[model samples]
Target: MDELSDADLERYARHVILDEIGEEGQIALLEAKVCVVGAGGLGSPVLLYLAAAGVGTIGLVDFDRVDRTNLQRQIAHTDAAAGTPKAESAAARARAINPAIRIEPHDVKLTPETVERVLTPYDLVVDGTDNFTIRLLLNDACYLMKKPLVSASVVRFEGQLSTYRAFEEGPCYRCLFDAEPTEGLVPRCDTAGILGPVAGVMGTLQATEVLKQITGLGSGMVGKLMLFDALDYSMQIIRTRKNPDCPLCGATPAITRVGG
Candidate 1:
């Protein structure tokens, strides 16, 4: 465990003052490692807060480059960084916020061969991507890796978030979402158009869940799904259960291993 330096004490004084997250929790944040799989809207707040909270090492993975259109919600990237890789851009902002911690930029595509390697080093995984293939891939990979996955997605006026740790007999993502949505069945955020802060709301909550996962503080959201309707300003927590017949974490499992 890393001890808090005089500077760390001063820097995180607000956090250190909290009875729940005193010096011990500050150290836990400083010693923790997290990987955020997207650098888009949701990933923006997740990465930035984790950095500001002093997560020891933050890894960002994205193959896309920043675009001017992304400026509306991808808050991590600046206009000058429009053409740079999203992961690198996001990492730059995180490092700027807290140079005390390490930020790794994985500017690579997610392949079956690379998913495990990409996720292996981190203590937790945050999914902010909208692609169904990558989402399912991450769900399966995280379960196989026995790592906790904090995932969030925003589309139009609503978004949802969840934390999964199936290896501990908790509900895996697959338990609730057994199959990927059929292609074209669900519209992309680009076409469907998201309300900007909806991403921020969910991502901020995701970051909170990440902190909770690390420090063992507050209610852990392992077996619950949070749904927020930005249009009506309503929020609900729905209980989740592990499925006995789900392919991934079921009694008779079909996905014994991850990847092809």
Candidate 2:
């Protein structure tokens, strides 16, 4: 266990004051290694809070560049950072928030051949990505590695979040999404058009789950999916179960390797 420095105690006074997250939890947060695999809308709050809360090491994976249009909800990037790689921009912001923490920015696209190498160093992975291919690839890799994955997705005025840990008692992503959706069928935030605040709401919730996992504070959303609708401010949680026939995490698994 890492002892909190005087600066750390001062920086995380609020966390230390909470019974749920006292000095012990604060130290755990400072010793955790987390990777947020996207630097766009959902990644904003996830990165910011993880850094602010003293997560010791954070890895950022992104391939896109920050555009001026992303400022509406991609709060991590500033007007001056336009055209910079999303991972780089987000890393700068996180460093600004907490220079004590280490930030590793991987400004590269995630491919099957490279996913394992890039993600293996982290304790947990956050699926802030909006791409189906990467999401499926990550689910397979993480399940095989037996690492916890905190995932969230948002489009239009609604969003959904769930934590997948097939190694544990929860279902893997493949249990619900057995296969990737056909291209052009599922819309992304760019095409479907999302309400700006929707990202903030979902991303914050996503960050909360990440903290919970790090501290083991409360029950996680392992077999549960949370649905948030901004239209009427309604939220619903749907319970899910592991699929014994899930191809990725099933009894007779087919995927033998990260990219197989």
Candidate 3:
């Protein structure tokens, strides 16, 4: 592991002072690689904080280009980047935050075939994607790769966060939602509208979970879901358990590959 640079020491002064995340923990963060599966609302703060915290390598996957409406929540992209690709915009911001960090931008959607190929190299995966299809795919890919996944979702004023390490015996995302919700059941941000700061709160929490896992500071939400109600400013914690019949991690498994 490389020692902290003087600049890093000063930039992360507060983190370095904390016994939970001293120079040693910071070094561990410098050697860690994390993949973020979106560059939109939930991804904005997650990418920013993780990069500032000195995660050694970050992979950003997104194929969308920036739009005028994205400014409300996608903090990484600016007016100048309104027409730029989301991943490129996010990667630029991440690089600006911490040049020492290596950011690999995948300017494409993560299909089942490409999921494992993109995710296998990372130490951990952060699911900031909005749709259930991408979320389930990421969960299954992480399970197959035996990697830890920090998943978070935000819609309107409410959001959910969970961490899954199925390879370590915790429940996969499939255990939480047996099957994908029916179409139109949950409105997306574009259709339902979202409070920008609400996404910030959830994304920041997701980044916190990632850092906690990286530094081993506190116990992660490995088998629990954190529900945040921005309107009431209340948080609820629900415990989760592995399902023996879970198609992905069960005794009689069906999912054998990234998309299977």
**Worst-scoring 10-residue span by lDDT in model 3:** 1-10
What's the distance in Å from true for residue 240, model 1?
A: 0.7
The prediction achieving the highest lDDT against the true structure is 2
Candidate 1 global TM-score: 0.98
Model 2: per-residue lDDT, tens digit, 1-260?
Answer: 65788988899999999999999999889889998999989999999999999999999999999998778999999999999899999999999999999999999889988898999899999999998889999899998898899999999999999999888778999899876678889989889988998999999999999999999988989999999999999999999998899888889988878988
TM-score of each: 0.98, 0.98, 0.97
Candidate 3, 1-260: lDDT as tens digits? 66888988988888999998999999999899999999999999999999999898999999999999979998988889988899999999999989988999999878987887888789899999888898889888888888999999988899999999989867999988878789999789988999999999999999999999999988899999999998899999999999999999989999987776
Question: Looking at model 2, how many pairs of residues clash?
Answer: 0
Q: After superposition, how far is residue 36 of candidate 1 from its true place, in Å?
A: 0.5
lDDT of 1 by residue, 76-151 (tens): 9999999989999899899999999999999988878899999999988999898988988899999888889999
lDDT of 3: 0.91
Every model: Cα RMSD to truth: 1.0, 0.9, 1.1
Q: Candidate 2, clashing residue pairs?
A: none
